[model samples]
Target: MRHRHAAAGPRRPRLPLRYLLPSVLLVVVVVMLLLRGYVHSEFLADHRVRPPAPTGTVPEKVLSGGPVLDARGETPVSHRVPDHKIVLTFDDGPDPEWTPKILDKLAQHRAHAVFFVTGTMTARYPELVRRMVEEGHEVGLHTFNHPDLSYQSSARVQRELAQSQLALAGAAGVHTSLFRPPYSSTADALDDRSWPVAREVARRGYITTFIDTDSEDWARPGVDEIVRRAMPERPGQGAVVLMHDSGGDRSQTVAALDRMLPELRAQGYEFPRLTEALGAPGPHSAVHGTDLWKARAFVAAVGVSESAMGVLVVALAVVGVLVVARFALMLLLSAVHARRVRRRRRGRGRDGRRPQVTEPVTVLVPAYNERECITATVRSLAASDHPIEVIVVDDGSTDGTADLVEALGLPGVRVLRQPNAGKAAALNNGLRHASCDLVVMMDGDTVFEPSTVRELVQPFADPDVGAVAGNAKVGNRRRLIGAWQHIEYVMGFNLDRRMYDVLRCMPTIPGAVGAFRREALWRAGGMSDDTLAEDTDVTMALHRHGWRVVYAERARAWTEAPETVKQLWSQRYRWSYGTMQAIWKHRRAVLERGPSGRFGRVGLPLVTLFTVFAPLLAPLIDVFFVYGLVFGPTLRTAAAWCGVLAVQAVCAAYAFRLDRERLTPLLTLPLQQLLYRQLMYVVLMQSWITALTGGRLRWQKLRRTGLLGSAPGALSGSGAEAREPHGLYGPGEAREPRTKSAVG
Candidate 1:
């Protein structure tokens, strides 16, 4: 005999570090992406502040001074580029296409220029920044993300400058003290709004640099126009020329640079670096040690995040296609199944008029510690409209469930006691003693309606049908947890069952209520204990044995669902793992010929795709949903999420309509997706971890409240009726029966 102590209940294992590390890395990548603002374009938008109408709050000397300003002392100092020298400074660059051409043209002319790079681009294409430093060009900070710092707070400005420095340090192992605010042009244009920002930049030890001339290259003006505009008006006058090599098509700027560099040199105006033109010390400083490593790590993380985002985008697309395809298949096939059932009811087809099944069936009630529910279960069976001989196999319940059932003394019900063998073994024992050709199996906690047995057996009228799966409804659905499960049953389970039935690949006959032919059971080698989910294992076996299995939607049974999160987790964990085990056990059928091979090709793949693969990847939708909300466009992200939810709601509404259920329960569908669905995903993930590590799972019995038995009318549309107890003995007056046996 199988003892309860032989195997231990499922225990929580310490999460392996391998799994933990990847999760941590993913979180880090997401954070890096958010910090870099690479997923959104708002940071890169060209924002102009219109010079703010010139205010006296700005220092007149600073406003009218040269492009390079330093205000570290009480008296602000400014210096202009030397006469007959031109400082060519490019903004918004490190562009892989245009920056190189501009750099190459300058190199060909032996001319040096300053390229002010944005932190976003610097981090993304570090090689370009490295190349700028290698080619004897000055690299200055233009603020990270190219934000207009005049409108930003001191803290925001500090962060921008610090991040830019970090990017510079990471890319080329050097940082520059020169800074430029995005959207600022010409020192004379600085007003009260921008003058204070320049003072703050000077206070931070940076030489705030502005332009003396605007090339207007960003407008993609003609190359000749750009070159002409970039030149100083006077022959000997010095100028700091502003142009761009990034932020849009810069081919015009590149051509302009190619013509202007040598032409300016030919005009006796030397194109020198900004610091050289200003006659100041070099601003670039080499980074070392921990700071260098940290900067490099930051850049490495940004690169990884970009790559990971690409992969996630592809995964999201794949999930999108899978979800839409599954929904389409379910909606179409479920309608076909419903229509066929309607036609059968109307007697409109060749095989529509099936004879009513009236033969007595032996119902097996497998009980383990089910004293609270045994009485109502036996009474409900005795009240069945269709004749049934119920064998209540009490599998070593410590609560005296066998004595309680025997005491009830229902006329057609017999109590058989045995040692604490597992549920599958108890089922097999019950099957051995059944005298009826048709057998119905149900859990001890399930309460069937008066007509359930009749409707369940009606499918047997077709000789090829070997088994029928019944509709299992949640009885305690007034609670939130139960309501979520009710929605899942209606949408995820029942609707999928309809589709699977249409495809002739129904994977599971739920243990709550199902019926099978004795010949089919015998041919399939009875219920085996190899898998925790005996019902599913046996169902797959019958398919391989060449017997047809189908769904009986009219045969509805009310069973209590798990009430708490902990209970739900344990129950689903077992179900997930057990289903995987059963699928793995029947894997060989896929390679075989005949009915087994047919089931293997059609049923196995569908089951794997819908049940295993789809759900495993489904979490990516929510993952990216959160990612988009944080780092991407909020309106689009929310709209996409609602679109997916709306599709789910449609499918759920149709499922409820088909099952003749009320739609009020669907109000919690969004919450179910937000919270309840995540728990199920975690359960499935843990199951995968357990399976991959070759961990064993034992049977877990949920704590029942006997709610289904106590209140049969609580479940709507279950067709349940409350019946008074009728038996040979009163509730507590009978002795134990003699039909007990031990199994070895």
Candidate 2:
């Protein structure tokens, strides 16, 4: 039986214009690529790129460039064949639009015209070539790529003609002894310089063709202008008229033909094919079957190369858009955050400290093969001003991580051990074992500031506040890459956190240091394993469940960032992929009608735009910048790129100011943009591609260096990697931190 509301199934949301536009662009790019070779050889032929020899001026005379001569230096075909008739000749096309229309007009007037098409265009539109031949129109050679023959050697000219012959044979199964050289715009344009090419055509038994009258239709002049240029002023004997069917818009040429053909016939002039008017020897041989197959295969190869170039152009455009948008949005959002920070400071008393909380809280330290910095992290947590119960949950560490914590003998500190589970699973287990109403979680590689736990837990004093996001600083910023990451964390991550706080869609509370109300965590179904970004996933779940999440700027944690590019890629790949997964998992929240809806509609979209769209587009900026440096107005392109860099610098400055960080890293901003920025976009794209392909999203852990320090400048040098701060546990004695597992 059908339910009462069965008729109304949930309607899927429409794809955004951004996605649709790119899809259309991608299709156009693909199609263009398939015709890539054709475009280059034919469309770009007239540009005179890379001629074989120097192009000197060609002058018109008795032996102008176009016509072929016999062994006795006379015309191959007598021009004055018969009076009261004209030979109509066309060149350059077989264009999709104009060629067919021209063919239709000729059929209507019961006339025949010879179409001299370049090899590239013939291969691209073979049907047009076949159709012209089937309709009683003759076909002639116009070279393969249309390079200026005057600048070519005898061999090059021969090769050009042969290729066109093969192309015509393959396309329409005919090998006529007719030829026209490129750059021979008119009979007058050919001169002594063009003799070698004409001789080469004659050597191949071809009657080199030229026109007595030019239509000038390739210029796309108006219909009247074309007719005026093409038609003879008075009736003439055996006049050969030239026109084109391609290369540009040919509407005017078609219109001119429509008017000229009828009027010419009205004056008792008959249109004859070139062979009929000028005469030609009979066919020596039909198109060879082997040559036809070779021609088709050769054209297919050209199409592939064309497609590749087109795809590249489109990709560059997309990346350019992404990069520019990222810079603009970052600047705007960071400025808003920085201004808000200043206003808040002005409103508060000096130092702007919130009242210290005295409540006891449970701290969950989840360790997984983390032996280097676990001691420092636990020590830092133990020294918090507020009373706290430390629960060290070791998720099957081979390095005896739990034993070291238990051996420390700190008061109110306990250890729990479990099989190797992921961070999310370990956290869920820890959450179950904790007894306090408020809980704080920290990564084993992270060391909290003395007052971090206190400030993080303070937000829980209000029943409405469910979780507090802490400021996560890079603890290993001594390397060039590390310094770049420090800048990113302070600017891109922290500043964005401030904005998200104001927007009430705090997407993530970093696992390094975050405080949560235990009941709220339980209400949101504890930690979920659905996304690689477990912290972000859970926080978003809380928002959907109507819990207020805010950033606690005063709460700081020094966490080790990835030190190498390989590590960084792996870490970010997981992070970005997981974030996408979480966003999708909670996608329905956009329609939940309250806080979740606001977050989905507002925060989720913003996250997608910046994280996915912006980064995806960012690389195009560099592609163009590099391209311009090589082949374009270098100074202007550089200035435009620098302008974008300036915007980024301003945003970074504001973000550093808000984080109360030094401006030293700004020195590396240019280098970072050139190198690090591209890497990040690649990581983002690779991760998203992985997600789309349904590849496994595994957890990757960065090797802990245990170099994090509490004071400023501690993360600035190679010396910081000496050892962990061990003086807190004893006097003048330091031992390598150890790890061991326990049942309870």
- Clash counts per candidate, in order, are 0, 18
Against the hidden true structure, what lDDT does model 2 obtain?
A: 0.73
Model 1 TM-score (2 dp): 0.90
TM-score of each: 0.90, 0.77
lDDT of 2 by residue, 1-744 (tens): 000111224333433442244445435544554356344553334455332333353323433433322322444432443566767888887788889999999999899988989887887777899898888888888888888877677877777777787777777778877777765744444445675666667767776677667888888778998888777646754567889888888888888888998888887889977667656553224666677678777666555555566666676666556655655665666566556645654656343644556878999988876777777778777667788999998887777689888888999998999876667788888999998989999888887766777767766655788999998888677689989999888878887787788777888889888999999999999988778888999999999989999887767778888888887987787788888888899999878798889888988887887777777666556755765565446899899899878877987888776666778878999999889877777677666656665665445566655665342222322112222222233433344543321211
Query: What Cα-based lDDT does every candidate model obtain?
Result: 0.82, 0.73
| Model 1: per-residue Cα lDDT over 402-448, one tens digit each | 99888886788887788787788888889999999999999898888
**lDDT of model 1, residue 683:** 75
Q: Which candidate is the best by TM-score?
A: 1
lDDT of 1: 0.82
Cα RMSD to the true fold for all candidates: 4.8, 8.9
